[model samples]
Target: MYEKLVELQSSTHEEATQQMVADEEDRRRGLEAAKLQLAEMEEKRNVSLLTPFLKVAIVETNSPAFEAGLRSGYQILQFGTVTSTVLASQGPSALMSATAEGVLLPVWVREEDQGEPRKILVVPHRWEGKGLLGCSFDPIRAK
Candidate 1:
């Protein structure tokens, strides 16, 4: 009877240890999933912060802006570091200063027909036309 009791206690201890390990694994996986979900939420919030402040008035054919997939009626959400707030305070100079020759600038734009915004890299380089971008932009005035 004494030997049997020791054997039962040993078996119970082993089972408890295995259960603890399984619970810990499940907890680790849940933590990882929560972290991923938080990251995705932060990304969406950052993208939402960029509001459309300018609209593309013209995009010359074969130009840098045109080649970068910019088109007329597309709204410019963020040009390099120029966001909606910056555009309101500093105006077009902020955007013009951002476009350095031979440098690739990240531009976030929203299409007129689409609800989501897209990112496009525009390289400011001299083309056959006048300006570096060969595109004209108009400010989106508040209603």
Candidate 2:
């Protein structure tokens, strides 16, 4: 009879241990979900205005945008326009300004797997040194 009691106690202990493991797993999953949520929010908040053909490569450490986040593989899919409601001190307006001063052409472009329409705009504010930002691009012909 004592053996039967001992067996019952062992089974109860095992079940309790299983329950604790499951609880820990549940807590872990919940924490992971929260982390992903925060990252998504940051990403949505981080993007700037969309542009066409804006070079999407990262600026080098010695380059102009190095003090900026301009990490390798990060792109400038957009420019000039605000990406979100909250504007951060670190943003892309400087790049746009430089481009306006004949630094580069401002245009919209997207990369692979983005799953969005791949085009943006650049307002034609006539700056002395800048090239054209018009929609119409044409091929040059030999004379």
Candidate 3:
């Protein structure tokens, strides 16, 4: 009878050890999945870093910017010879407003089809629209 009791105890101990091993394996798999998810998020962030700026939210019909072929979802890469990097750093509103009147503001834009940014000359004028440029922009991060 004593021997039978010892044998039962041994079986219980073995079962408990197996359960612990299974639990540890599950934990390891969960941690690995979390790491993979974090890596994917980092990759997306790095890709966005290449083009940092807001996309045009609106392009008023018949406006100068619209006449120049500007459209919504297009990213304004530059506000002239100045790169978006420089303009973005100085504040988009201030730099854009500082442009001299009648000076054809050369701009770089990334359209849907364009592989890289293309230069587009936009002549800002007080037209029948809401804003000076007749367009609205929202930062990518905001989206």
Candidate 4:
């Protein structure tokens, strides 16, 4: 009878431990979901406050963009002859079209709020890896 009681107690302890682990996993999943939702909300808020302008998101090492002093977070106002909303809507395709044929396209960059916008020439050239322009961009939206 004592042996039976001991065995039953061990089973109960194992079940309790398993329940604790399951509960922890459930809490972890809930926390992860909450974190993801928060991140999405933050991104939406950031987009809402920004103006409709394209900004460089990345510049690859030793690429033409990098060599031309193009860095991440630089706002691109004009891509060649295109400007404003037109550039915002068709920036990526326009960039590809303008640069794919070894053309030197003029790009206006507003580096700072107090500084004047300056133009830079970009030649889209194929490199060792990834994007042809060696850069990525994000559209800035108005608040």
Candidate 3 lDDT over residue span 1-143, tens digit each: 99999999999999999999999999999999999989867743443344536578898899888998888988766565444566656766655664555678866677755555665678787888765578777766523
lDDT of 4 by residue, 1-143 (tens): 99999999999999999999999999999999999999967744543333336788889888878877788878876666555555567755765566664768766677746245666777777777576677888877755
- Which candidate leads the pack in TM-score? 1
Whole-model lDDT values for every prediction: 0.88, 0.44, 0.71, 0.72
Question: How many Å off is the CA of 63 in candidate 1?
Answer: 0.0
Flag regions of model 2 displaced more than 4 Å.
48-143
Q: lDDT, candidate 2, residue 36?
A: 95
Clashes in model 4: which pairs? 50-141, 51-140, 51-141
Task: Give TM per candidate.
Answer: 0.68, 0.36, 0.54, 0.56
Winner on lDDT between 2 and 3 is: 3
Poorest stretch of ten by lDDT in candidate 4:
43-52
Which pairs clash in the backbone of model 3?
none
| lDDT tens per residue, model 1, 5-116 | 9999999999999999999999999999999999967754686567788899999999999999999999988888899898789977998889999999988888875777
Clash number for candidate 2: 10
Which sections of candidate 1 miss by over 4 Å? 1-45
C-alpha lDDT of candidate 1 relative to the true structure: 0.88
Give the clashing residue pairs of candidate 2, or none: 49-78, 50-78, 51-78, 51-107, 51-108, 52-107, 52-108, 53-107, 53-108, 53-109
Position 124, candidate 1: lDDT: 92
Clash number for every model? 0, 10, 0, 3
Best by lDDT: 1
